[model samples]
Target: MSGEFDRVARLRAIFAGAHRGVILGIGDDAAILAGDVLATGAVLSTDAAIEDVHFRRAWIGQGVTWRDVAYRAAAAALSDLAAMGAEPRAMLTSWAFPRDVGDDVVDEIARGFRDAADVYGAPVIGGNLARAREIGLTTTVIGAAPARAPRRDGAQAGDVLWATGALGEAALGLAALEAGIAREPDAAAFVSRFVRPPSRIDAGRAAAQSAHAMIDVSDGLLQDLGHLCDASGVGARLDALAPTREADALARRLGVDARALLESGGDDYELLITAAPGVDLSRIAHPIGEITREPGIVGATTARTGFDHFG
Candidate 1:
Protein backbone atom coordinates (compact mmCIF):
# COMPACT_ATOMS: atom_id res chain seq x y z
CA MET A 1 0.00 0.00 0.00
CA SER A 2 1.80 3.05 -1.25
CA GLY A 3 1.56 6.08 1.03
CA GLU A 4 0.23 3.92 3.87
CA PHE A 5 0.88 5.27 7.34
CA ASP A 6 1.91 2.62 9.89
CA ARG A 7 -0.34 4.08 12.56
CA VAL A 8 -0.88 1.05 14.78
CA ALA A 9 2.82 0.30 15.07
CA ARG A 10 3.69 3.94 15.68
CA LEU A 11 1.02 4.25 18.36
CA ARG A 12 2.33 1.16 20.09
CA ALA A 13 5.80 2.68 20.14
CA ILE A 14 4.40 5.92 21.58
CA PHE A 15 2.83 4.00 24.46
CA ALA A 16 5.88 4.33 26.68
CA GLY A 17 3.83 3.72 29.86
CA ALA A 18 4.18 6.84 32.00
CA HIS A 19 1.92 9.76 32.69
CA ARG A 20 3.58 13.18 32.53
CA GLY A 21 2.15 15.82 34.93
CA VAL A 22 -0.32 14.76 37.56
CA ILE A 23 -0.58 15.38 41.27
CA LEU A 24 -4.05 13.81 40.97
CA GLY A 25 -6.14 12.08 38.32
CA ILE A 26 -9.71 10.75 37.78
CA GLY A 27 -10.96 10.62 41.38
CA ASP A 28 -11.72 14.11 42.65
CA ASP A 29 -13.97 17.11 42.27
CA ALA A 30 -11.34 18.39 39.87
CA ALA A 31 -7.98 17.09 38.80
CA ILE A 32 -4.79 18.41 40.38
CA LEU A 33 -1.74 18.79 38.18
CA ALA A 34 1.79 20.13 38.19
CA GLY A 35 1.46 23.54 36.56
CA ASP A 36 5.18 23.82 36.03
CA VAL A 37 5.12 20.78 33.75
CA LEU A 38 4.08 22.97 30.90
CA ALA A 39 6.71 25.63 31.64
CA THR A 40 6.90 26.58 27.99
CA GLY A 41 3.15 27.09 27.39
CA ALA A 42 -0.16 25.24 27.39
CA VAL A 43 -2.22 23.96 24.50
CA LEU A 44 -5.80 22.94 25.20
CA SER A 45 -8.45 21.44 22.92
CA THR A 46 -11.81 19.64 23.10
CA ASP A 47 -13.99 17.46 20.84
CA ALA A 48 -17.41 15.85 21.03
CA ALA A 49 -18.65 12.53 19.66
CA ILE A 50 -22.35 11.79 19.81
CA GLU A 51 -23.99 8.48 19.00
CA ASP A 52 -26.10 8.28 15.84
CA VAL A 53 -24.26 11.44 14.82
CA HIS A 54 -20.60 10.66 15.22
CA PHE A 55 -21.21 6.89 15.31
CA ARG A 56 -23.84 4.20 15.39
CA ARG A 57 -24.00 1.54 18.11
CA ALA A 58 -24.52 -1.25 15.59
CA TRP A 59 -21.32 -0.33 13.81
CA ILE A 60 -19.27 -0.81 16.96
CA GLY A 61 -19.21 -4.31 18.49
CA GLN A 62 -22.81 -4.82 17.41
CA GLY A 63 -24.16 -2.32 19.98
CA VAL A 64 -22.69 -4.42 22.82
CA THR A 65 -19.87 -1.97 23.69
CA TRP A 66 -18.56 1.52 23.04
CA ARG A 67 -14.82 1.17 23.60
CA ASP A 68 -13.91 2.30 20.10
CA VAL A 69 -16.28 5.24 20.30
CA ALA A 70 -14.62 6.69 23.36
CA TYR A 71 -11.12 6.07 22.05
CA ARG A 72 -11.93 7.83 18.79
CA ALA A 73 -13.35 10.76 20.70
CA ALA A 74 -10.08 11.17 22.56
CA ALA A 75 -8.06 10.88 19.35
CA ALA A 76 -10.13 13.60 17.73
CA ALA A 77 -9.37 15.99 20.56
CA LEU A 78 -5.72 15.05 20.73
CA SER A 79 -5.40 15.69 17.00
CA ASP A 80 -6.07 19.35 17.76
CA LEU A 81 -3.12 19.41 20.13
CA ALA A 82 -1.07 17.77 17.40
CA ALA A 83 -2.00 20.56 15.02
CA MET A 84 -0.59 23.00 17.54
CA GLY A 85 2.58 20.88 17.94
CA ALA A 86 1.83 20.02 21.54
CA GLU A 87 2.79 17.09 23.74
CA PRO A 88 -0.13 15.92 25.84
CA ARG A 89 0.04 16.38 29.59
CA ALA A 90 -3.43 15.40 30.77
CA MET A 91 -6.90 14.63 29.51
CA LEU A 92 -10.50 14.89 30.69
CA THR A 93 -13.69 13.28 29.42
CA SER A 94 -17.37 13.96 30.07
CA TRP A 95 -19.69 11.15 29.14
CA ALA A 96 -23.43 11.24 28.58
CA PHE A 97 -25.07 7.89 29.22
CA PRO A 98 -28.55 6.48 28.93
CA ARG A 99 -30.25 6.19 32.30
CA ASP A 100 -30.73 2.44 31.96
CA VAL A 101 -27.22 1.57 30.82
CA GLY A 102 -25.40 -1.01 32.92
CA ASP A 103 -22.13 -0.72 34.84
CA ASP A 104 -20.32 -3.08 32.43
CA VAL A 105 -21.06 -0.72 29.54
CA VAL A 106 -19.64 2.21 31.46
CA ASP A 107 -16.59 0.16 32.34
CA GLU A 108 -15.92 -0.60 28.70
CA ILE A 109 -16.09 3.10 27.83
CA ALA A 110 -13.68 3.93 30.63
CA ARG A 111 -11.29 1.29 29.42
CA GLY A 112 -11.40 2.87 26.00
CA PHE A 113 -10.50 6.22 27.46
CA ARG A 114 -7.62 4.65 29.36
CA ASP A 115 -6.25 2.96 26.28
CA ALA A 116 -6.36 6.12 24.17
CA ALA A 117 -4.75 8.21 26.90
CA ASP A 118 -2.00 5.62 27.24
CA VAL A 119 -1.02 6.05 23.61
CA TYR A 120 -0.07 9.67 24.24
CA GLY A 121 1.25 9.16 27.80
CA ALA A 122 -1.49 11.47 29.00
CA PRO A 123 -3.48 10.49 32.06
CA VAL A 124 -7.20 10.90 32.36
CA ILE A 125 -7.46 13.71 34.86
CA GLY A 126 -11.19 14.32 35.36
CA GLY A 127 -14.61 14.53 33.73
CA ASN A 128 -18.36 14.70 34.39
CA LEU A 129 -21.07 12.21 33.59
CA ALA A 130 -24.71 12.89 32.80
CA ARG A 131 -27.80 10.91 31.86
CA ALA A 132 -29.06 11.42 28.36
CA ARG A 133 -31.35 9.80 25.80
CA GLU A 134 -28.31 8.92 23.73
CA ILE A 135 -24.67 8.27 24.55
CA GLY A 136 -22.03 10.92 23.79
CA LEU A 137 -18.51 11.80 24.86
CA THR A 138 -16.62 15.06 24.98
CA THR A 139 -12.87 14.92 25.49
CA THR A 140 -10.50 17.70 26.45
CA VAL A 141 -6.72 17.48 26.24
CA ILE A 142 -4.03 19.77 27.65
CA GLY A 143 -0.47 19.62 26.40
CA ALA A 144 2.85 21.45 26.52
CA ALA A 145 3.47 23.67 23.53
CA PRO A 146 6.60 25.08 21.95
CA ALA A 147 7.49 28.73 22.49
CA ARG A 148 5.91 29.47 19.12
CA ALA A 149 3.47 26.68 18.34
CA PRO A 150 2.41 26.35 14.75
CA ARG A 151 -0.56 28.48 13.69
CA ARG A 152 -2.97 28.14 10.80
CA ASP A 153 -2.47 31.75 9.74
CA GLY A 154 1.28 31.65 9.16
CA ALA A 155 1.43 30.22 5.62
CA GLN A 156 3.16 32.18 2.87
CA ALA A 157 2.03 32.35 -0.76
CA GLY A 158 4.91 30.25 -2.13
CA ASP A 159 5.05 27.65 0.63
CA VAL A 160 4.77 24.00 -0.33
CA LEU A 161 1.79 22.08 1.02
CA TRP A 162 2.29 18.63 2.52
CA ALA A 163 0.19 15.89 4.16
CA THR A 164 1.19 13.56 6.98
CA GLY A 165 -0.65 10.41 5.97
CA ALA A 166 -2.82 8.70 3.42
CA LEU A 167 -6.10 10.38 2.59
CA GLY A 168 -9.41 8.53 1.89
CA GLU A 169 -8.46 5.38 3.82
CA ALA A 170 -10.60 6.26 6.80
CA ALA A 171 -13.40 7.39 4.57
CA LEU A 172 -13.17 4.06 2.82
CA GLY A 173 -13.20 2.37 6.20
CA LEU A 174 -16.32 4.34 7.04
CA ALA A 175 -18.06 3.26 3.86
CA ALA A 176 -17.11 -0.37 4.49
CA LEU A 177 -18.42 -0.19 8.02
CA GLU A 178 -21.72 1.30 6.90
CA ALA A 179 -22.12 -1.24 4.12
CA GLY A 180 -20.97 -4.14 6.33
CA ILE A 181 -18.69 -5.28 3.53
CA ALA A 182 -15.34 -6.24 4.94
CA ARG A 183 -14.89 -9.47 3.04
CA GLU A 184 -11.72 -8.36 1.28
CA PRO A 185 -8.41 -7.57 2.96
CA ASP A 186 -8.58 -4.02 1.67
CA ALA A 187 -12.07 -3.67 3.05
CA ALA A 188 -11.02 -4.96 6.45
CA ALA A 189 -8.03 -2.62 6.42
CA PHE A 190 -10.27 0.29 5.62
CA VAL A 191 -12.62 -0.71 8.44
CA SER A 192 -9.69 -0.64 10.84
CA ARG A 193 -8.64 2.76 9.55
CA PHE A 194 -12.08 4.10 10.43
CA VAL A 195 -12.25 2.22 13.73
CA ARG A 196 -8.87 3.31 15.07
CA PRO A 197 -7.65 6.50 13.47
CA PRO A 198 -4.30 7.95 14.62
CA SER A 199 -3.35 11.49 15.56
CA ARG A 200 -0.07 12.58 13.91
CA ILE A 201 1.48 14.10 17.03
CA ASP A 202 5.11 13.33 16.19
CA ALA A 203 4.70 14.39 12.59
CA GLY A 204 3.09 17.62 13.67
CA ARG A 205 5.95 18.33 16.03
CA ALA A 206 8.52 17.74 13.31
CA ALA A 207 6.61 19.83 10.81
CA ALA A 208 6.12 22.61 13.34
CA GLN A 209 9.84 23.20 13.38
CA SER A 210 9.71 24.19 9.73
CA ALA A 211 6.06 24.44 8.71
CA HIS A 212 4.87 28.01 8.30
CA ALA A 213 1.28 26.88 8.98
CA MET A 214 -0.48 23.63 9.92
CA ILE A 215 -3.93 22.11 10.30
CA ASP A 216 -5.31 18.64 10.90
CA VAL A 217 -7.07 16.91 8.06
CA SER A 218 -10.10 15.89 10.09
CA ASP A 219 -12.73 17.53 7.90
CA GLY A 220 -11.22 16.27 4.64
CA LEU A 221 -8.14 17.58 2.84
CA LEU A 222 -9.76 20.13 0.56
CA GLN A 223 -11.99 21.69 3.19
CA ASP A 224 -9.33 21.75 5.89
CA LEU A 225 -6.78 23.18 3.45
CA GLY A 226 -9.33 25.80 2.48
CA HIS A 227 -9.49 26.71 6.16
CA LEU A 228 -5.70 27.00 6.33
CA CYS A 229 -5.66 29.17 3.22
CA ASP A 230 -8.44 31.35 4.58
CA ALA A 231 -6.64 31.86 7.84
CA SER A 232 -3.29 32.50 6.18
CA GLY A 233 -4.77 34.81 3.54
CA VAL A 234 -3.65 32.56 0.67
CA GLY A 235 -4.97 29.89 -1.68
CA ALA A 236 -3.60 26.50 -2.87
CA ARG A 237 -2.88 24.47 -5.96
CA LEU A 238 -3.36 20.72 -5.49
CA ASP A 239 -1.02 19.55 -8.22
CA ALA A 240 -1.32 15.86 -7.42
CA LEU A 241 -3.23 13.43 -5.20
CA ALA A 242 -2.31 9.84 -4.46
CA PRO A 243 -4.96 7.60 -2.99
CA THR A 244 -3.79 4.18 -1.89
CA ARG A 245 -4.74 1.21 -4.08
CA GLU A 246 -6.75 -0.19 -1.18
CA ALA A 247 -8.73 3.00 -0.98
CA ASP A 248 -9.13 3.04 -4.75
CA ALA A 249 -10.43 -0.50 -4.91
CA LEU A 250 -12.75 -0.02 -1.98
CA ALA A 251 -14.16 3.13 -3.50
CA ARG A 252 -14.88 1.30 -6.72
CA ARG A 253 -16.61 -1.48 -4.83
CA LEU A 254 -18.67 1.10 -2.97
CA GLY A 255 -19.56 2.84 -6.24
CA VAL A 256 -17.96 6.15 -5.38
CA ASP A 257 -15.16 8.07 -7.01
CA ALA A 258 -11.84 7.37 -5.31
CA ARG A 259 -10.51 10.78 -6.22
CA ALA A 260 -13.49 12.48 -4.67
CA LEU A 261 -13.04 10.48 -1.49
CA LEU A 262 -9.35 11.39 -1.42
CA GLU A 263 -10.19 15.04 -1.86
CA SER A 264 -13.23 15.44 0.42
CA GLY A 265 -13.75 12.47 2.73
CA GLY A 266 -13.20 13.39 6.38
CA ASP A 267 -12.06 11.75 9.66
CA ASP A 268 -8.50 11.19 8.44
CA TYR A 269 -6.79 13.02 11.38
CA GLU A 270 -3.67 13.60 9.26
CA LEU A 271 -1.87 16.92 9.29
CA LEU A 272 -1.71 19.40 6.40
CA ILE A 273 1.28 21.68 6.42
CA THR A 274 2.85 24.57 4.54
CA ALA A 275 6.64 24.95 4.53
CA ALA A 276 9.43 26.46 2.51
CA PRO A 277 10.76 24.43 -0.44
CA GLY A 278 14.03 23.21 1.11
CA VAL A 279 12.49 22.14 4.42
CA ASP A 280 12.42 18.33 4.67
CA LEU A 281 9.22 16.78 6.06
CA SER A 282 9.72 13.66 3.90
CA ARG A 283 10.13 11.31 6.84
CA ILE A 284 6.73 12.30 8.21
CA ALA A 285 4.76 13.96 5.40
CA HIS A 286 4.76 14.40 1.62
CA PRO A 287 4.19 17.33 -0.67
CA ILE A 288 0.78 17.58 -2.31
CA GLY A 289 0.50 21.13 -3.50
CA GLU A 290 1.64 24.77 -3.24
CA ILE A 291 0.21 27.80 -1.50
CA THR A 292 -1.16 30.35 -3.97
CA ARG A 293 -1.85 34.06 -3.82
CA GLU A 294 -5.34 33.41 -5.22
CA PRO A 295 -8.29 33.01 -2.89
CA GLY A 296 -9.44 29.38 -3.43
CA ILE A 297 -8.19 25.87 -4.14
CA VAL A 298 -7.42 25.12 -7.74
CA GLY A 299 -6.04 22.22 -9.88
CA ALA A 300 -8.09 19.37 -8.42
CA THR A 301 -9.44 17.13 -11.18
CA THR A 302 -12.88 17.14 -9.63
CA ALA A 303 -15.12 19.66 -7.90
CA ARG A 304 -15.39 18.48 -4.32
CA THR A 305 -17.12 19.32 -1.04
CA GLY A 306 -16.09 18.15 2.40
CA PHE A 307 -18.13 16.93 5.36
CA ASP A 308 -20.54 19.54 6.68
CA HIS A 309 -21.98 18.85 10.14
CA PHE A 310 -25.06 20.89 9.31
CA GLY A 311 -25.33 19.72 5.72
Candidate 2:
Protein backbone atom coordinates (compact mmCIF):
# COMPACT_ATOMS: atom_id res chain seq x y z
CA MET A 1 0.00 0.00 0.00
CA SER A 2 3.01 2.27 0.08
CA GLY A 3 4.63 3.08 -3.23
CA GLU A 4 2.60 3.14 -6.41
CA PHE A 5 -0.62 2.59 -4.54
CA ASP A 6 -0.01 5.55 -2.29
CA ARG A 7 0.87 7.82 -5.17
CA VAL A 8 -2.20 6.77 -7.14
CA ALA A 9 -4.32 7.13 -4.06
CA ARG A 10 -3.09 10.68 -3.50
CA LEU A 11 -3.81 11.54 -7.08
CA ARG A 12 -7.26 9.97 -6.90
CA ALA A 13 -8.12 11.88 -3.77
CA ILE A 14 -7.01 15.17 -5.30
CA PHE A 15 -8.53 14.65 -8.73
CA ALA A 16 -11.86 13.25 -7.69
CA GLY A 17 -14.61 14.57 -10.02
CA ALA A 18 -12.02 16.64 -11.87
CA HIS A 19 -12.43 14.96 -15.25
CA ARG A 20 -15.65 15.04 -17.26
CA GLY A 21 -17.11 12.59 -19.77
CA VAL A 22 -14.73 9.88 -18.65
CA ILE A 23 -16.39 6.48 -18.67
CA LEU A 24 -13.70 5.25 -16.31
CA GLY A 25 -10.56 6.79 -14.87
CA ILE A 26 -7.47 6.59 -12.59
CA GLY A 27 -7.81 3.14 -11.02
CA ASP A 28 -8.53 0.79 -13.92
CA ASP A 29 -6.33 -0.77 -16.61
CA ALA A 30 -7.23 1.99 -19.09
CA ALA A 31 -9.40 5.09 -18.93
CA ILE A 32 -12.48 5.17 -21.11
CA LEU A 33 -12.48 7.98 -23.69
CA ALA A 34 -16.26 8.60 -23.40
CA GLY A 35 -17.26 7.58 -26.91
CA ASP A 36 -19.33 4.62 -27.93
CA VAL A 37 -17.68 1.88 -30.01
CA LEU A 38 -19.37 -1.45 -30.49
CA ALA A 39 -21.92 -0.49 -27.82
CA THR A 40 -19.14 0.28 -25.29
CA GLY A 41 -16.85 3.20 -24.71
CA ALA A 42 -13.43 3.67 -26.26
CA VAL A 43 -10.47 2.95 -23.98
CA LEU A 44 -7.21 4.83 -23.79
CA SER A 45 -3.98 4.07 -21.94
CA THR A 46 -0.29 5.02 -22.09
CA ASP A 47 2.82 3.22 -20.89
CA ALA A 48 6.49 4.14 -20.82
CA ALA A 49 9.61 1.97 -20.86
CA ILE A 50 12.87 3.62 -19.95
CA GLU A 51 16.10 2.14 -21.28
CA ASP A 52 17.55 1.15 -17.91
CA VAL A 53 14.44 0.89 -15.79
CA HIS A 54 12.28 -1.33 -17.96
CA PHE A 55 15.02 -2.94 -20.05
CA ARG A 56 18.78 -3.13 -20.55
CA ARG A 57 21.28 -2.87 -23.38
CA ALA A 58 22.52 -6.44 -22.96
CA TRP A 59 19.12 -7.72 -24.00
CA ILE A 60 18.86 -5.43 -27.04
CA GLY A 61 20.92 -7.79 -29.22
CA GLN A 62 20.69 -10.95 -27.15
CA GLY A 63 17.23 -12.03 -26.08
CA VAL A 64 15.47 -9.09 -27.78
CA THR A 65 16.09 -7.04 -30.89
CA TRP A 66 15.33 -3.33 -31.10
CA ARG A 67 12.12 -4.23 -32.89
CA ASP A 68 11.24 -6.48 -30.02
CA VAL A 69 11.71 -3.57 -27.65
CA ALA A 70 9.21 -1.50 -29.60
CA TYR A 71 6.89 -4.45 -29.77
CA ARG A 72 7.13 -5.13 -26.07
CA ALA A 73 6.61 -1.48 -25.25
CA ALA A 74 3.49 -1.40 -27.38
CA ALA A 75 2.30 -4.70 -26.01
CA ALA A 76 2.70 -3.48 -22.46
CA ALA A 77 0.40 -0.53 -23.05
CA LEU A 78 -2.05 -2.48 -25.12
CA SER A 79 -2.30 -5.00 -22.30
CA ASP A 80 -4.05 -2.31 -20.28
CA LEU A 81 -6.76 -2.01 -22.90
CA ALA A 82 -6.91 -5.78 -22.98
CA ALA A 83 -7.72 -5.75 -19.29
CA MET A 84 -10.67 -3.60 -20.19
CA GLY A 85 -11.58 -6.00 -23.02
CA ALA A 86 -10.99 -3.31 -25.60
CA GLU A 87 -10.19 -3.89 -29.25
CA PRO A 88 -7.20 -1.88 -30.37
CA ARG A 89 -7.87 1.20 -32.50
CA ALA A 90 -4.60 3.09 -32.95
CA MET A 91 -1.33 3.82 -31.16
CA LEU A 92 1.06 6.77 -30.98
CA THR A 93 4.64 6.64 -29.79
CA SER A 94 6.93 9.25 -28.28
CA TRP A 95 10.62 8.54 -28.32
CA ALA A 96 13.65 10.16 -26.71
CA PHE A 97 17.12 9.20 -27.84
CA PRO A 98 20.71 10.02 -27.06
CA ARG A 99 22.52 12.48 -29.32
CA ASP A 100 25.11 10.02 -30.70
CA VAL A 101 22.75 7.10 -31.39
CA GLY A 102 23.06 6.34 -35.11
CA ASP A 103 20.29 6.75 -37.66
CA ASP A 104 20.45 3.03 -38.48
CA VAL A 105 19.66 2.12 -34.89
CA VAL A 106 16.85 4.62 -34.97
CA ASP A 107 15.57 3.05 -38.17
CA GLU A 108 15.62 -0.33 -36.51
CA ILE A 109 13.60 1.12 -33.66
CA ALA A 110 11.11 2.54 -36.17
CA ARG A 111 10.87 -0.87 -37.82
CA GLY A 112 10.19 -2.32 -34.42
CA PHE A 113 7.38 0.14 -33.80
CA ARG A 114 5.89 -0.40 -37.22
CA ASP A 115 6.03 -4.15 -36.88
CA ALA A 116 4.33 -4.14 -33.48
CA ALA A 117 1.70 -1.63 -34.52
CA ASP A 118 0.80 -3.79 -37.47
CA VAL A 119 0.07 -6.72 -35.20
CA TYR A 120 -2.82 -5.03 -33.39
CA GLY A 121 -3.98 -3.21 -36.52
CA ALA A 122 -3.14 -0.17 -34.49
CA PRO A 123 -1.39 2.24 -36.78
CA VAL A 124 1.58 4.19 -35.54
CA ILE A 125 0.00 7.63 -35.50
CA GLY A 126 2.51 10.47 -35.55
CA GLY A 127 4.20 11.56 -32.30
CA ASN A 128 7.11 13.67 -31.09
CA LEU A 129 10.83 12.93 -31.02
CA ALA A 130 13.28 14.67 -28.75
CA ARG A 131 16.91 14.51 -27.62
CA ALA A 132 17.39 12.71 -24.36
CA ARG A 133 20.11 11.36 -22.09
CA GLU A 134 18.97 7.75 -22.65
CA ILE A 135 16.48 5.69 -24.57
CA GLY A 136 12.97 6.66 -23.43
CA LEU A 137 9.93 5.27 -25.19
CA THR A 138 6.24 5.87 -24.53
CA THR A 139 3.28 4.20 -26.20
CA THR A 140 -0.32 5.33 -26.17
CA VAL A 141 -2.89 2.78 -27.31
CA ILE A 142 -6.62 3.29 -28.01
CA GLY A 143 -9.13 0.49 -28.12
CA ALA A 144 -12.88 -0.31 -27.93
CA ALA A 145 -15.15 -3.00 -26.56
CA PRO A 146 -18.64 -4.15 -27.51
CA ALA A 147 -19.71 -5.23 -24.07
CA ARG A 148 -18.53 -2.65 -21.62
CA ALA A 149 -14.94 -3.50 -20.81
CA PRO A 150 -14.35 -5.09 -17.42
CA ARG A 151 -13.80 -2.81 -14.45
CA ARG A 152 -11.69 -3.42 -11.36
CA ASP A 153 -14.43 -2.35 -8.95
CA GLY A 154 -17.23 -4.65 -10.13
CA ALA A 155 -16.47 -7.77 -8.11
CA GLN A 156 -19.16 -9.07 -5.83
CA ALA A 157 -18.58 -11.02 -2.67
CA GLY A 158 -18.43 -14.78 -3.27
CA ASP A 159 -17.08 -14.45 -6.83
CA VAL A 160 -14.39 -16.94 -7.78
CA LEU A 161 -10.93 -15.92 -8.98
CA TRP A 162 -9.29 -17.07 -12.20
CA ALA A 163 -6.34 -16.28 -14.46
CA THR A 164 -5.17 -16.75 -18.02
CA GLY A 165 -2.09 -18.75 -19.03
CA ALA A 166 0.80 -19.66 -16.75
CA LEU A 167 2.71 -17.12 -14.70
CA GLY A 168 6.31 -16.35 -13.66
CA GLU A 169 7.97 -17.42 -16.91
CA ALA A 170 8.91 -13.84 -17.68
CA ALA A 171 10.29 -13.31 -14.21
CA LEU A 172 12.38 -16.42 -14.54
CA GLY A 173 13.44 -15.25 -17.96
CA LEU A 174 14.62 -11.98 -16.49
CA ALA A 175 16.41 -13.92 -13.77
CA ALA A 176 18.21 -16.00 -16.36
CA LEU A 177 19.26 -12.92 -18.27
CA GLU A 178 20.57 -11.26 -15.13
CA ALA A 179 22.45 -14.35 -13.99
CA GLY A 180 24.33 -14.75 -17.26
CA ILE A 181 22.52 -18.04 -17.90
CA ALA A 182 20.55 -16.89 -20.90
CA ARG A 183 22.89 -18.70 -23.29
CA GLU A 184 21.82 -22.05 -21.87
CA PRO A 185 19.90 -24.43 -24.12
CA ASP A 186 16.61 -24.15 -22.25
CA ALA A 187 16.58 -20.37 -22.22
CA ALA A 188 14.55 -19.71 -25.34
CA ALA A 189 11.12 -19.81 -23.67
CA PHE A 190 12.35 -17.83 -20.75
CA VAL A 191 13.80 -15.16 -23.01
CA SER A 192 10.70 -15.03 -25.17
CA ARG A 193 8.41 -14.75 -22.18
CA PHE A 194 10.55 -11.97 -20.79
CA VAL A 195 11.11 -10.11 -24.03
CA ARG A 196 7.72 -10.45 -25.71
CA PRO A 197 4.99 -11.42 -23.27
CA PRO A 198 1.53 -12.11 -24.62
CA SER A 199 -1.10 -9.41 -24.04
CA ARG A 200 -3.86 -11.99 -23.42
CA ILE A 201 -6.28 -9.74 -25.27
CA ASP A 202 -8.60 -12.51 -26.32
CA ALA A 203 -8.61 -14.06 -22.90
CA GLY A 204 -9.38 -10.72 -21.28
CA ARG A 205 -12.08 -9.85 -23.78
CA ALA A 206 -13.77 -13.19 -23.23
CA ALA A 207 -13.57 -12.86 -19.48
CA ALA A 208 -15.30 -9.51 -19.69
CA GLN A 209 -18.48 -11.32 -20.58
CA SER A 210 -18.68 -12.97 -17.18
CA ALA A 211 -16.05 -11.41 -14.98
CA HIS A 212 -17.31 -9.29 -12.13
CA ALA A 213 -14.00 -7.51 -12.00
CA MET A 214 -10.69 -7.83 -13.86
CA ILE A 215 -7.16 -6.54 -13.97
CA ASP A 216 -3.97 -7.27 -15.90
CA VAL A 217 -1.17 -8.86 -13.93
CA SER A 218 1.68 -6.52 -14.79
CA ASP A 219 3.05 -6.52 -11.28
CA GLY A 220 3.13 -9.74 -9.28
CA LEU A 221 -0.21 -11.54 -8.99
CA LEU A 222 -0.51 -10.61 -5.34
CA GLN A 223 -0.13 -6.89 -5.97
CA ASP A 224 -2.57 -6.85 -8.84
CA LEU A 225 -5.06 -8.81 -6.81
CA GLY A 226 -4.78 -6.22 -4.11
CA HIS A 227 -5.66 -3.60 -6.69
CA LEU A 228 -8.78 -5.51 -7.64
CA CYS A 229 -9.68 -6.03 -4.00
CA ASP A 230 -9.20 -2.37 -3.16
CA ALA A 231 -11.27 -1.32 -6.08
CA SER A 232 -14.10 -3.65 -5.19
CA GLY A 233 -13.94 -2.90 -1.47
CA VAL A 234 -13.61 -6.57 -0.74
CA GLY A 235 -11.32 -9.29 0.60
CA ALA A 236 -10.05 -12.57 -0.85
CA ARG A 237 -8.65 -15.96 0.11
CA LEU A 238 -6.42 -17.88 -2.29
CA ASP A 239 -6.26 -21.63 -2.45
CA ALA A 240 -3.09 -23.00 -0.93
CA LEU A 241 -3.04 -25.83 -3.42
CA ALA A 242 -3.54 -23.59 -6.41
CA PRO A 243 -1.11 -24.99 -8.96
CA THR A 244 2.21 -23.39 -9.74
CA ARG A 245 2.21 -21.80 -13.18
CA GLU A 246 5.91 -21.77 -14.04
CA ALA A 247 7.51 -24.64 -15.92
CA ASP A 248 9.14 -27.09 -13.53
CA ALA A 249 12.19 -27.63 -15.73
CA LEU A 250 12.83 -23.92 -15.99
CA ALA A 251 12.40 -23.55 -12.25
CA ARG A 252 14.95 -26.29 -11.69
CA ARG A 253 17.37 -24.57 -14.04
CA LEU A 254 17.09 -21.39 -12.03
CA GLY A 255 17.28 -23.17 -8.68
CA VAL A 256 13.93 -21.67 -7.68
CA ASP A 257 10.62 -23.03 -6.58
CA ALA A 258 8.17 -22.72 -9.47
CA ARG A 259 5.36 -21.85 -7.09
CA ALA A 260 7.35 -19.01 -5.61
CA LEU A 261 8.04 -17.54 -9.01
CA LEU A 262 4.41 -17.91 -10.06
CA GLU A 263 3.26 -16.00 -7.02
CA SER A 264 5.74 -13.14 -7.12
CA GLY A 265 7.09 -12.58 -10.61
CA GLY A 266 6.08 -9.54 -12.64
CA ASP A 267 5.52 -8.99 -16.39
CA ASP A 268 3.55 -12.12 -17.17
CA TYR A 269 0.86 -9.89 -18.74
CA GLU A 270 -1.84 -12.38 -17.79
CA LEU A 271 -5.41 -11.56 -16.75
CA LEU A 272 -6.56 -11.82 -13.13
CA ILE A 273 -10.31 -12.13 -13.02
CA THR A 274 -13.06 -12.55 -10.48
CA ALA A 275 -16.30 -13.85 -11.86
CA ALA A 276 -19.74 -14.68 -10.50
CA PRO A 277 -19.95 -18.00 -8.69
CA GLY A 278 -20.87 -20.93 -10.97
CA VAL A 279 -19.80 -19.05 -14.09
CA ASP A 280 -18.19 -21.40 -16.57
CA LEU A 281 -14.65 -20.12 -17.21
CA SER A 282 -12.93 -23.27 -18.42
CA ARG A 283 -12.34 -22.06 -21.95
CA ILE A 284 -10.84 -18.69 -21.05
CA ALA A 285 -9.11 -18.89 -17.66
CA HIS A 286 -7.91 -21.25 -14.96
CA PRO A 287 -9.45 -21.22 -11.50
CA ILE A 288 -7.12 -19.80 -8.86
CA GLY A 289 -9.10 -18.76 -5.77
CA GLU A 290 -12.29 -17.24 -4.38
CA ILE A 291 -13.41 -13.82 -3.29
CA THR A 292 -14.58 -13.33 0.30
CA ARG A 293 -16.71 -10.84 2.16
CA GLU A 294 -13.75 -10.23 4.43
CA PRO A 295 -11.14 -7.69 3.36
CA GLY A 296 -7.74 -9.32 2.90
CA ILE A 297 -6.08 -12.25 1.18
CA VAL A 298 -6.05 -15.17 3.54
CA GLY A 299 -4.87 -18.79 3.52
CA ALA A 300 -1.58 -18.01 1.77
CA THR A 301 1.49 -19.54 3.37
CA THR A 302 3.76 -16.75 2.20
CA ALA A 303 2.73 -13.12 2.03
CA ARG A 304 3.97 -11.21 -1.02
CA THR A 305 3.51 -7.99 -2.98
CA GLY A 306 4.23 -7.47 -6.67
CA PHE A 307 6.92 -5.25 -8.25
CA ASP A 308 6.73 -1.64 -7.03
CA HIS A 309 9.15 0.99 -8.21
CA PHE A 310 9.88 2.29 -4.72
CA GLY A 311 9.17 -0.70 -2.57
Q: What's the lDDT for residue 169 in model 1?
A: 82
Model 2, 119-181: lDDT tens per residue? 665655445567799999898887776366679998888999998887777888888887777
- Cα displacement (Å) at residue 164, model 1: 0.6
lDDT of 1 by residue, 1-311 (tens): 11113422332233323455687665446877787988888899989999898888777563223777777888888999899988888888887877666665666677777788888767777777677899889988999997668899999999999988788788888887788775456687777677678868888887878889999988888899989999999999997786777677778889888888789888999999999988888999888999999889998876658878899
Candidate 2 scores a C-alpha RMSD against the true structure in Å of 10.2
TM-score of each: 0.91, 0.83
Question: What lDDT does model 1 reach?
Answer: 0.80
Model 1 residue pairs with clashes: 173-190
lDDT of each: 0.80, 0.75
Question: Which runs in model 1 stand beyond 4 Å of their true positions?
Answer: 1-18, 62-65
